[model samples]
Target: MEKNLAQKYNHKDVEEGRYDEWVKKGYFTAGDKSKDPFTIVIPPPNVTGILHIGHAWDNTLQDIISRYKRMQGYDMLYLPGMDHAGIATQARVDARLKSEGISRYDIGREKFLERAWQWKEEYAATIRKQWAKLGNSLDYSRERFTMDEGFNDAVRHVFVTLYNEGLIYRGWRIINWDPEARTALSNIEVYYQDDPGKMYYFDYKVEETNEYFTVATTRPETMFGDVCVVVNPEDERFSHLVGKHAVNPANGEAIPIIADSYVDVEFGTGAMKCTPAHDPNDFAIAERHGLEKPICMNPDGTMNALSGEYEGMDRYECRDKLVERIKEEGNLIKIEDITHNVAHSERTHCVIEPYLSEQWFVKMKPLAEDVLKNQNDPDQRINFYPERFSRVFEQWLENIEDWCISRQLWWG
Candidate 1:
């Protein structure tokens, strides 16, 4: 009918014609807010995006609700927007530029940012166009981008206020880092996968006394950052060596072997490597002893200057190289293939790097107390569709990590 009817009749194209009319008539534009205002913030599509079926469904639902509310005489503010999706948006443009023989490095961050803003303006129209087709009553005049001045100011304000209120702090904490995107990601952005890898058993010799103690590790690449060797304080297996040192086979660096009550006595060798910069558990141990964190790899998960012999190699490559070195020294006791969960970035899908960074984190405890203890309000008017989503909302907010809102990318 689309092909045959259009040629036979002068009827305007249904999708485009109606969409243009609605935009011009301003049915979708929100008027001034009254004392009573109703708003359903359409979850902003990431700026690094194209609308898919799921997004379309979401917009359709929101539009229906907004229209219903507008008819009910509520000042409707179905705010439209897009996210400055830091890594995601940057990756999209970067890939598009790769075909043109241009890299982000060639144009620089400033120019790349300009191009990204151009992208936002271009796609923002498509969002409105989609909404119009779905017959949604969105206030296009008030459409906001995540990077808009007011919103960015709000993000900054939240950060500064939280900091002043002692609800936010900077500390050397273990964070999930994206290797390919070179950024710290919130826990929500990480997906876990079971990886098949080997656990290497290396004999650590005391520096002063030639007595040896064995430690098993799945990640030999982090050996360069090993500051201490920890054992269960009550474990009888290695109680004699409580105050001794252990020699890292490949690095020959001596690390104090101490007993900690936190150590699980059953987990291999009853001893673990304390790499403050790498393992979350080790960071706690380091904090207990007031030791410095030495990050062995770059933000991209490549060996940094700290990884002496493997400075230019990938972290995984350094693993193999380090294993070989340990094997030659006769410290390699045994190897076992084991399945373990590894976290990967949601955007890049690359294995995440665990790094100690002084990133910002909010104290969720106080926020939780307020939100949990407060009674459900009839006048507050908070709502979500499908009703089930409210449970998801409550559950998410219940155990939310200190939101790390910073990103390394310049473009969005």
Candidate 2:
């Protein structure tokens, strides 16, 4: 022990020598069956990352707990790892490629993925070296990457099992789609911006009756996809209008005027346009009322062939054209200036469209039920740090919906 100590207290020399000795002695290794096991699985950080303060804080806390357990005569297995960070890593590589006057599409998916793995290897080594600098007692030998073959197999098995149990399904549903990524993102992956907007009120002529009723909408461009105009069933003024059909001002398509409880009578016009293929709430109303879902826009935010004359136009461009067309046709009742929040893609910073696409989803209700049960149990295995976090967990589990898991990106 005296010989191991350096005459001069040099951190670099002393620490490196000790770490090398520890590694050589297999002190940070695991797989011994002769002791009480205490395992700690690392919350893998994104590989497309630099060691930051947050990473240091998290790893320090984990290391503290792991070391305390080890001192208590437990066989500690604090496994270290990093995630491939699918979308994030791809975005970074794409940006890098763009700087070199090239794009991921130029090299194709296979070549792009090769570059991604190369980037992974380079940064992962940096992350590991940075983690080692902290001298955390981690089992480096048991390191796992999210995209590793064993991890990939585990993920596939779980997905297949869920699918077999009917917990996983595919359907054409309205999702927050990132036009740039060309992928459907989950609700949590989207951020919203509050901006000024106008609510356009247009007259929809009742087919059965010659009388015209005004329906207010924020998106006039999506009118081409409108399948029904809904009103509160309890509203006496529009109760008589139920079972009637109205002509869409944009394309002159005869759409049903249905009455449902989903309509907010206090809101604008007390009438909501049901564009099942575009709006999530409207999609739900359409499903409840059995309405046809006619998509007006493509995945890339361009109007599709179903949009009549507005076809082949960008959504914003179509909005301008539709407004002018509606004004010319004498269907424009009034336009009220309003402010609203719109969802945007977290990665692309592009306006996210509530697009209808066939994608895989996992039923979250059952999973939430299990989580809630575990949370509420008196002898719960996991405990939240702050007691109030338990309530937040409960609230999240209570209001969970089906999670969209599939993305239209080649990276993952």
What is the per-residue lDDT of model 2 for residues 197-280, given as tens digits with 9 covering 90 to 100?
999999989998799888999998888889989999999889888989999998998988888898999899898888998899
Rate residue 351 of model 1 by lDDT.
90
What is the C-alpha local distance difference test score of each model?
Answer: 0.81, 0.87
TM-score of each: 0.86, 0.86
Q: Provide C-alpha RMSD values for all models, in order.
A: 4.1, 3.6
lDDT of 1 by residue, 112-192 (tens): 888878877777777666666666667778878887899878988988888899998876689989877778888888999
Number of the top lDDT candidate:
2
TM-score quality measure for candidate 1: 0.86
Quote the RMSD, in angstroms, for model 2: 3.6
